[model samples]
Target chain A: MKDTNDWKQICSEYLANVDAALVNATVEEKQQILNDITIHLNERYHELSDEEQTWEHYQQILTDLGPVEDYAELLNEKSPDKKKFQKHRKAFWILLCAGIGCVSVLACSIGFFSHSAIKKARESKRPVVVKTFPAALDRTVDPDTTEITVTFDQPMMNFSWSWVGGGEHFPETTGQPRYDKERTTCTLPVKLKPGHWYWVGINSEKFVYFQTAKHIPAKPYAILFATADKNGNPTEIPIDYIEETKRVNSK
Target chain B: MNFNNWKIQLRKGLLELVVLKLLSSGQFYGYEMVKTLKTIKGFSIREGNIYPILARLKTDKLVVIEQQVSPDGPVRNSYAITEAGRLMLEKMTAHWKDVIETIDTLTAGDTK
Candidate 1:
C-alpha cells in the first residue's frame, strides 16, 4: 500500500516539476502539454503489472520521457519568432538597466532616500499565512483529516502555490492544491497515516509559488503535526524523528 | 563525436519527419503515436518528446488536434495531418530520398 502511494507521489511531483519548467509557454500551450503528458503517464502506469508498479518502475517511465526542462527548451525552439522576441526583450532590458543605472547615480548624489521607501513598500506588500486548518505544530491532528487549508493575509494569484517539502516527513498529497474563490485560502488534499508525523512547508526559497497578486512571495512557514492513532491517543514519535525533522528543516 | 551521440542527433532531426509520416496514414492519440514510433527500430523516440513536435506542427498548421472520447477511458487528444502537412511531408520524403541516394553513391567505393 505504501509503495503504491509512493509511486503516485513520484508521479505527482514529476508533473508539478514539468509544469514549473514550462514558464515561457502560453496558457493554452502549457495546458495541452500537461494534458498530453498526463494521458501518456496514466496509460503507461495502467500497463504495469501489480508487482512492477513500484516507484522505481514509475521513475523509469519518467526517464523515458526525458528531463522536464527539455520540454520548455523544445517548446521555445518550436514557437515561431521566439528567438527574435527574446533578442528584442534582452536589448530592451539592457537599455532599461542602463537608464536605471543613470537614475541610481543621480539618486546617490542627491540623498538615496528611496532605498528605505522601496524596502518599506516591499515589507508592507509581503504576504503572510494567516491560519492553517490543523494549526502549526499541532500534536494531535486526526489521521482522517483529508485536507490542509492555508489562509493568507492577502489575495493570492490563482494556480500559484508551493506546498514544498519532501521525504517521509512530508504528507502525501492526493490532489493538486487549489485556492478558494477569493484566492486567499488554499487547500491541499493529503493522505495521512495514523501515528505518523507530517511536515509541510509553504513557499521555500526555491519553490516560492505562494505569492500575492503583486508577486511578493509569502514568508516561509512550516506546519508540523502528528496524527492521532485509532484510539485518539497521541502516539510516540517514530524512530527517525530527529533525521526527519532535520530533513524538513533543511528544506 | 561519439557514434551514439551522432545517432541521437540524427534521430532527433528525423523525428519531426517520422511524426508527420505517421499522421499521414491516420489520426492517432498522443499515446498511440508514441507506441507506434517506439516499435520502429531506429526511429524510437522518448514518449514525452512527441507532444512538443505535435504542438509545433499544430502551430504551423501542419496538423490538427481533435478531442476524442475513448470507450474505456477519458477524452484523448487525437492528431491528424492537415493538407499543408501532406504537402510538406511529400517534399521531406523527396529530400530524404535524394540524401539517401547521394550518401549511397558517395560510400559505394568504400572497402569497409
Candidate 2:
C-alpha cells in the first residue's frame, strides 16, 4: 500500500514539475489545469487496489498523459500564442532600448574625456570619482523603495558591488547596470530591508581611459541609510530589524 | 500523407464538433469526457487533457460550468453545452456531411 507520505510526495513533485514546465499558461489556466489534474489523480488513486499501488502503476498513468510541455504547447496553440508573443516582443524592445542606452553612454563618456577634466584628474591622482546615491554614507531613505543607484564621473568599463555587511547579505538584484544616455550614471535595483546598515564593496576594474593593468581597486563603499518606518518616520525601526536579546543564532 | 497523420488531422479539425455533440447529450467533467471519448476507436485521450479544449469552449461561451459535490471527494467541475454550443454543433454537422459527401464522390470506387 502506498503510504500517505509517498502519495503526497509523488503527487506534489509531479504537479510542481508540471507547473514549472508550463511557462506560457495564464494564471487561471494553470490553476484550472492543476485542479483538473488533482481531481483525476485522486480518482485514479482511489480506483487502485493495494496490490496495484506501485510506482510502475503511477508511472504508466503519468506517461500516458505525456510530457507536460506537450500540454503547454497545445494550450499555447489553442489560445493563439499571441499573449506569449507579445510578452517576448515587449522584453525584446526593453533589451534593445537598454543596449542603445549603454552604447550611447559609452560614446558620450569617451567624447567627454578625450582631452578634458578626466586627464587632469588622472594626473593629480585624486579619487577618480565619488558619485553614487544614498550619496556616500547617507543616513535616511524610504524603506519601501527597491533600488539604490550609483553614478560615476567617468564611464566605467566594468563595475560590480557586493554586500560586505548588513542585516542580511544583499538580496538578489534584478537586471544589470542600466547606464543612462550620458553613460555617467547606472541604476541597480537592489532588495534592501528597512532600518538596516549595508556595506557594499565597489569595484570598477576598468575604465575607458585606463587599461586593465593600470586599473586600481577603488575604496570599499558603504550605504548607511536607515529605511523609514511605515509612518514614513526615520526614527522608528521595523519589527524585523529589532534584534531580540534572547534570540538564538542558528549558525 | 500517411494514414495516422491524416487521422490526427481529421480529428483535430473535427474536435470541437465532436465535443459539442458529446456534451449535447449530457454534462461531463474533464475526466469523464476523456473516458467517454475513449470508447470510440481512434479517440484515445488521457485524463485532464480535455481541460484546455473545455476551457476554450468556456471562454467562447459555448459551454457553462456547474459545480457538483462528489460523494467520494471534493466538488467536481462539470461542463454542459449551451444553446450556442448546440447551434455550432448543428452547423458543423451539416458542413461535415457535405464534406464527407464530396469526398465520397471524389473517391468513389477507389477503395479496394
Give the best candidate by lDDT: 1
DockQ of each: 0.25, 0.13
Worst 10 residues of 2 chain A by lDDT: A242-251
lDDT by residue (tens digit), candidate 1, A1-251: 22667666656766776787687765566788889998888898888988887755776787688656457656766466455566787999999999999999899779865777898889788888888887765778999999999999998765567787776778876655666657799989888999887778888878677876556888787777788888888856554654554454443
In model 1, which runs have C-alpha deviations exceeding 4 angstroms? Answer: A1-4, A81-251
**Model 1 interface CAPRI class:** acceptable
lDDT of 2 at A103: 84
Superposed by TM-score, candidate 1 places the C-alpha of residue A167 at a distance from the truth, in angstroms, of 36
**What is the Cα root-mean-square deviation between model 1 and the actual structure?**
13.9
lDDT of 2 by residue, A25-102 (tens): 666667777877787777777778998887657655565554454455456653544476568879989999999888
Minimal lDDT window, size 10, model 1 chain B: B1-10
Query: What would the per-residue lDDT of candidate 1 be over residues B1-112, giving only the tens digit for each residue?
Result: 3454466578777888999999989999999999999999877676788887777778778999999887999888999999999999999999999999989988986746
